[model samples]
Target: MSEIQEEAVLEQDQIIVESGRPKMLGYVFGFFAVTLLGYFLVNRYYMPAPAVNTAPAVRFAPSELLNDLNKRLAYLQNRTTGVSFYIHTIRKKENLWKLASKRHYSVHAIIGCNPQFETYDVSIGQKIIIPSRAGTLHPVQKNDSWQKIASRYKTTLPELVKYNNTALDIGYGDLVFVPDRRPDMALMNDKLREKYELRALFVSPLGGRLSSTFGRRKHPVTGQYKLHGGIDIAVKTGTWVGAAADGVVTLASDGVGHYGKAVFVDHQDGYVTHYGHLSKILVRPGQKVKARQLIARSGSTGRSTGPHLHFTIKKNDVSKDPLKFIW
Candidate 1:
C-alpha cells in the first residue's frame, strides 16, 4: 500500500470515532430526560396520595338516634298539653312536700301523680313522676249533666263547658278532662266568708271535742307507725253526724275497710269529706245534701276505740288537715 493511502485511512478512522462518540452521548442524555419526565408525571397523576393522620369518624346506631328523637318529641307533646309530665331525679334532702311547695303544687297533687309514694315513705335518689299541673281524669256516667260534673270536679260550669267544648248535656261514657280548680287566694280571704254567710264555714260531723288529730301516729290496735287519715271526734253513740259541706253523696255504705258505715260527700272544687265510724248511714249514694244536714249517726265502728265520728277532708283524693279548712 502507498504512504498517502495509509494517511487517508487513519484520518477517516479518527473522524468516524469522534462523530460516533458525540451521537452516543446525545442518545444517552435524551433517554435520561424522558425517564425523569415519566417519573414526575407518574408521581403527580397516577400514584396514590399520601395518608393523612386523623381520627376515625364516629357513628351512631339508627335505633338509638330514633329513640332520642322520640323522647324529645314526647317531651314537646307533654308541654303542649295542659299538664307536663316529666321524670324528676330526687336530689339530696329533697322530699315530696318540698318539691310540691317549690312547684306550687299541693301535697295531694304530688300524691295523685305518684300513687306509689306514701306520705312519709319517699327517700333520696328516688325518681319521681312530676306533673306540671294539678287535675284528674273523670269519666262521665249515664244521665250526667254538665252542672253535676262541674260540681263534682269543683270547677265552674263555664270552664267545664269551654274545656270540653261540649254541650251542657253530656252523653254516657264520655271522657272529661278536669283541671285543678281553686278559688283565688287573695279574693277568697276577702269575700268567701261574706258571700256564703248563710252557710256555715264548715259544720262539725258530730257534737264532740277532738280526740285525735290528723297526722302520723301509732296505730292503737296494730301498734305500728301509720298516717292518721282523719280527725276523731269523740261522742256518745247514736249522736247525729252532720254533713260538713254541701255536696253529693259519692259513697254511703259499710263497704270501706277500717271505716265501717262510712259516708263520702264530694263537694265542689275538688273537695270531699268523709264521715266514718257511724252506727247508721242516713244518706244514699248520689243524694245531694246541704252543709250541716244530718247524714249519719256516730258510733264506735271498725278500728275505733270509742264512740266517735272520724272526719276526713280530701282534695282530689289527697287528704288534708280538716282544721285548716273548717272554722
Candidate 2:
C-alpha cells in the first residue's frame, strides 16, 4: 500500500479503538495533508541551493611570459643617456673644406654631425648634434698596438702603422699615441679656398681614359713591363694638371729617364707628393701650393705617348695608394 493510504488506515484503526463512535475519513485526509505540508516546509528551509557556474579557467603559458620579458629587455637596451645638443644641416657635396671656409663654423664642429649623415655624402634636411671630440685620440692606460688603435678609430691598421713607422705586429701593454692631428685637413680646405678657388681635389690628370692603375703596367713609352708607380690618366698634350695637396713645390725640371717635366712637393707631414709628365711647369721649385693649385700643364714630356698626370704619394720613402689621402 502507498504510504499516504497506509497512514490513513492507521488513523481509522486508532479512532475505532478510542470510541467506534466517530466517522474518521475526514480526519485521515487532514492528517495526510498536514504531513505533506510539513515535509515541503522542512525541505525548503533546511536544504542548500545549487551553485551557478560561470566562465572557464585560464592556463599559464611560459612562452607568452618569455616574450613579454624580452620586450622589456629590448626597451631597456635601446634607452640612451647623455647630454644632447643641436647640429646644423650639411648640404649635398659639402665637405670639411667647405665647412672650414665658413666664417661662423668650424671643422671640429662638423665632426659633431657625423651620426646624422647616412653616407660619406652629408644630406640636407637632416638633424644631428656634433659628437664630442673622439676619446682623446687614443687612450693611455693600456699598452696598445697599432691594429687595436686603428680599429678604435674607424681606420685601418696599415694606415696607422705606416704613419707611426711601426711594424704590422706591434706588441701589447706598450702604449703609444702614434702622433695624430686632424691631418690639418681643415687648413688645406681653408688654403684651397683662399688660393685655387677650385671646389675640387684633383685637377685634370689627363683628357684621356685611365690606361692602367697605379700598381703595375707596361709603360706606354718603354714597353718593358714595370711596376707603374702612379696612375696614367691619358690626355693629349697641353692638358692642365694641379697639385693634389697643399705643400711646397720641390722639383719642376727634367726630360730625364722616365719622368718628363716633373714636379715634386714636400707636403711636410712625413709625406712627399709628386706630379709628373707635364707639357709646362707653371710653378717653380720652393713655391707654396694649395690643393688644385696649377703646377703645370700636361704633355708627353716624359717617355709617354699621351699626356697624363703621374701622381704619387710617398711616406718615409715608401710609395702608397694616393687615394687614401685624397680629400
Best by lDDT: 1
Residue pairs with clashing backbones, model 1: 154-269
Error of 2 at 208 (Å): 6.0
Give the number of the best model, judged by TM-score.
Answer: 1
TM-score against truth, every candidate: 0.40, 0.38
For model 1, how does the per-residue alpha-carbon lDDT over 260-304 read when each residue is reduced to its tens digit?
A: 889999998788999988999999999999988999999888888
Clashes of each: 1, 6
lDDT of 2: 0.52
Runs off by more than 4 Å, candidate 1 = 1-201
Q: Which residue runs does candidate 2 get wrong by more than 4 Å?
A: 1-208
Q: After superposition, how far is residue 203 of candidate 1 from its true place, in Å?
A: 2.4
